[model samples]
Target: MRRRISMLAGVAALGLTLAACGGGGETPAEDSNAQDASGNVGVFTWWADGSEKAGLDALVKVFGTDYPDVTFDNLAVAGGAGSQAKSVLAAQLKAGNPPDSFQAHAGAELQDYIDADQLEDLSSFYTDNDLTAQFPADLVDRLTVDGKIYSVPSNIHRANVVWANVEVLKKAGIDPEKPAEDLEGWFADMDKIKATGTIPLAVAGSWTQVQLFENILLASLGAEGYNGLWDGSTDWKGAEVTDAIKAYEKALSYTNTDRDSLSDWAPATQLVQDGAAAYNVMGDWAEAKFAQDGDKPGVDYVYFPTPGTEGVFDFLADSFTLPKGAPNPAGAKAWLTTIGSAEGQAAFNKVKGSIPANTTAKTDDFSEYQKSAIADFGQDTIVSSLAHGAAVPVAWLNDLSTAVSKFGGDKDIDTLQSSLGDIGEKFAK
Candidate 1:
């Protein structure tokens, strides 16, 4: 992959420092040495339901314990992958009605906000709290652009995991533990699954499809080529992309017809866990869903890299940022300080089924899947996720998602590939 945002090497050096699951801590609002705060602090996020909501609640508990005086306003608009929340935030920011703090993925996704002066630099915030040393060095670098940091990351999520229902796979004559070597091999297994009258792949919404599309690109193009899609080294209209989407289209054939009814990704994940679906290709956040559904790993469920994506980590981080004209900057800082704290990360990421961004957080209570994810993240070849805003700005991703969504409806590969090419060209210019 390109060296521009090479983060795994740095993350690996510090990644294992993160520790166990969420155990509520503090005096009702204290995340270990968080400066006291008061008044209402509106923190915007997409984690309004399911295990994702649980993660936010865990963090909020820590915040409440540390800053008892502050009333935390949960300004969450439920949506898969912030599909709805981002647009709301954009509108609010433009109208000069910004939340005190908001969640954003920590890469090119922040570009538009920074360019438009919609965000406040958190560089001094980092220095004051000693957060620079707490997070992986390369991760810190990824957060910085023009020598300023605009957000404090909570956790790292891997986008290319395939969660499987062991029983469902077993019924389909598929080995839950042994992942297929590539897309073709995976599709062969999916065919068997389809014959079993099970959803071979449970996908929901455009975001999920875009996520699957990127994983297909990774499997087809490798890390360097996938990275090139974002960095402009690879042509989106090239033969490589055409061949890749063929696999993507093939993968889609095994999905459930009721995908449109499944608005959030959790229900789709639930299908796999409930044995109604054989597989669900989702980010590690699905781990939280598995746990939430009381599915045990290796027994009730299993996971691997999306076919052909083994040894590659499709990465995205969830971070909180201070808006330029936040209503309560001090309260927002308190929220951020708590978010960056080891205890807060421990609590939040534990329920979130993601590894903490803070390297120094405790790790003794993590689930088996989480432990495996931390290990994988430490050693895997990390690449930015196009669906989750690590690789492309939100606008560009929306363009890609629109094209992918349309493809899902129309099944027109030529139009899909051509539209994507135009999007790439437009973004590149």
Candidate 2:
């Protein structure tokens, strides 16, 4: 039987309080000396492959230039979208062995760490560095909890994007420039590609399915309804959600049959890159992967927001936080400062296939796709990404992911709807 939503809330609150209180371990002293001490700094993340790793290496290169005395420890664990890293992080935090700093999604996702008091309040760091002026106001708001900032954002990624192979589209006799306007239209294009002996869509297992589902929900419900999913203004059990699920089911039907065997997003992206598949719905980071493989944007592939989400930026950010018990608090602060710096973010995002979170960062080095994302991020209705831990708590997202995985095998809309409604009631509050 499923746990009651209220029960989960109580447990979460207790966990947060215990986590915040140091969990019976020696936490770093809150003094200028501790904040300035330099030694080895361990930075944890799940950026162990492809363009993501390249991005991390670029940032590390910049850090090495600035802090030559400090040894940079790359504690990257292999996982798609930090799935494996998160589990390790949770265990470490519980054992009172937090890294010097670690990557996290901005927004409600960081709330857990904030609640646990496992994170140092970076409010002073932001004020000292003038980050309040550098980053966008909306993005800063997302990174804040109860008026206290916890993390410094490195880059912004758009989740609702469909990357297509231009050559594959040409082979299927479909116009690459004119993408479909809705689900039905997208299905028509997929049918044409399928007829040409090419896989119409490519998707990886589990987490990517959640990524695709969130975009489908955005396309089906539009910005207002999608925002309501997090804020309690929308009905999860309503007909609109059901319609979104139906659309997701149809979309999944067009995906690669061996999707379960594809362990990470990079392989599925490679399917589109190699032209075994025509399209892949993934975050803009896939752009970085293609670029790393020596593929040019317009000539090799094209990207657009998923159907019906053209004007909205489905947003998430890669951010780093200073853990409470970090062995090198000063070094962690220095690392985070570098992450928020203009030069550092530019170097990182240029390789990572994302836009710098700092609005003041120069974009001349950014690709056409990244430039467009930056412009849209500034002008569009911004919404948090569910799959990437921006819109919900870790536990809530885990529950949702479990339901999605079960639904993939069961194909039971009724069960999916029930599980979704229960999650909404529990987490959306």
Residue 168 of model 1 has an lDDT of 88
As for candidate 2, its clashing pairs are 19-116, 20-116, 20-117
Off by over 4 Å in 2: 1-29, 33-37
Clashes of each: 12, 3
What's each prediction's TM-score? 0.92, 0.92
Q: Model 1 clash tally?
A: 12
lDDT of 2 by residue, 143-162 (tens): 66677777888888889999
Candidate 2 is scored at a TM of: 0.92
Per-residue lDDT tens digits for candidate 1, residues 307-334, read: 8888888888888887666666778888
